[model samples]
Target: MKKIFTINCGSTSTKVAYFEDDKMMCKSSLTITAEQLKEMPKTLDQLEFRTNQVEDFLKENNLDPKDFDIVVSRAGTIPSVPYDGAYEVNELMIASVTYAPEAQHASTLSCLIADKLVKGLDVPVIIYDPTCVDSADEIAKITGIPEITNMPVAHLLNTKMAGITYAESMGKDYKDLNLIIVQLGGGITLGFHDHGRIADWVYDDEGPMSPQRAGAIPTRYLADYCYKSNKTLQEMRMYLCGQSGLVAYFGTQDVRDVEKLIDEGDEKAGLILKAMAYGVAKSIGQLCVVRGGNVDQIILTGGVAYSERITEWIKEKVSFIAPVTVIPGEREMEALAAGGLRVLNNEEQVHPYIYYPKGYSSIEDIINNPNELA
Candidate 1:
């Protein structure tokens, strides 16, 4: 039996899980503070304050990275277009995430770990969704952003993990059933997975407005707001995704704090939370409709979905669409390890990732379009 070590990096934390002989033997999650993030550690010393506990846990468990057969992870990205799940990490992924046009701190950590592991270990290291952008040309043209066609299916792993777990719990294989997974994060993402593939997905550009995110706002209003604030497009984006959303609305990025305020009769807090739930329901409805309204279940995941209130609200909204199940916790690490195993065993075929220019759908469009860069 082989041992697999999975690492999942996020904006403020890192999660590691170890699987041996077909079972998860240990897991560690390390949380980091905003100040710690601001400093941007360039080495393991910089990561010390945050990961000291994790290092200690590993030491206590007598675990060694070198012992693992493979180290797998989900890499961060800049949003683009439609992509299928599963990919092998490459230099393109490394550069995209590490030197992303946008300053994505999560990507920084992923690269740091990837570099460290590949150099230190003899095992194979796989990054599934490292800033993948594989979009169809048609959608890219509509958005007028050529980079929109770069589609990385990062979410596929987590959604499928949730779906399979929920299905197995019900004595079924996910391949035989259709599932709609509503991930309530800074925004709400509705995805449909059927027969072992992602059929369709719709993400609220405004998100479910989390404790740290302001879900989608009216584009016009946002433009006006940015104008009034005299913020550039880059700054506006940073605020929209990183700062202004939930933190601006509620003064805290922790959903638990917001929920507490709501419990304390904070009307504004309650509204934002409800708004997120409504958005979630709406997205789920759209995905269900896309799947001909025969979704077997709606599985809710992500940080925000942990709240009982949010889950119940989304449940109420999706009750008519399908029976709803809330599977909290992001299973990114597990998915990566399992996916690596599947790919290694040749039990599944990894899809070829195609990076199409922003505005074209097919080869013809790319070749014939008058606007195409010559």
Candidate 2:
């Protein structure tokens, strides 16, 4: 029996899973809090801290990395997908991630975890269905941003994976069905699925002015505020991504807290909650347009999807679009493991979805001239 380890590093936590013969044997999620961040190692020193944590967990559980046939992870966004599905994290991909960076705490953490595993055991590390920026040709043309590929493709991939599992249980292939996937998480990612492939996706930049992010702010208004007010970039970022959303609207970002306030008849909280649900419903509607109004199922998945309040609101709004179902949490670990095994089994090929900076012909060309920009 071949064993595979799927490592997922979320923005706030790390999830490790062990799979044997495509079956998830064990899974663990270790959350890292702000207080932990204060005492935790910086970027360069994080490898030891991450490694020790995983090593201790495995030892206590009587498991070893050597037992695994492959190691898989969720990597950062590269550039653009040449096609679709999963891919391997090669030197080119790694270099691209290292050079042209984004706010990818999970991807960086995953690298540290993978480094530890590869050092202890000579296993190949693969990344599955990373944020594929494969915007439809028309969408790109409309957006006028060549880089604006479908940002929610990864959500679509995982949602489709879940759909297949659900369909298989009923002795049906997902390929024969049309589906809509609602990803309610740190952000809302909606996708239209046809025959198990992601046909189109619509995502809200930030989450609904939830307890966390300020959601989508009008760029012009934001710019005016920045100009009129004297605030540092960090301050603005914190307010926009963290404080302004539900916290700013209410007193807290916790959904439970918001719900409590709503139950207490706090009119303001009720309004905000309704607005968020409305935004999600609006996104679902946009996805329907992509499907040409032929949606079979509307499935909801993600961390926030667990909220009954949010789910109910979505269901009521999109009922006519199709039947809506909620699949709480994400399947990134399973997706990673599946991708790794696919590559190992020759069922998929590894390719770079991102291009090197400096507009170079290849990764080697960029590497050979590090001073090109200079």
Compose the digit string of candidate 2's lDDT tens values, residues 225-290.
988877776456545754576767765656888888889989988888889888888877877877
Clashes of each: 18, 4
**Candidate 1 residue-wise lDDT, 1-374, digit = tens:** 77877777665677878887457898877777777755753322344454455556568889876677766766555335344445555544443443332343454355446445556456666666443334322332334465553232325656777888998999999889988887666545666776655666664353456555566677788777878987765556656766765689777777888888998999988888788678778777766765578888888888777889889987877898788888997877777777767766777666543444444445455444523112
**lDDT for 233 (candidate 1):** 57
**After aligning candidate 2 to the native by TM-score, how far in Å is the CA of 244 from where it should be?**
4.2
- lDDT scores for all predictions? 0.64, 0.68
Model 2 regions more than 4 Å off: 38-48, 133-137, 144-154, 228-239, 242-244, 250-253, 351-354, 357-374
lDDT of 2: 0.68
TM-score of each model, in listed order: 0.79, 0.83
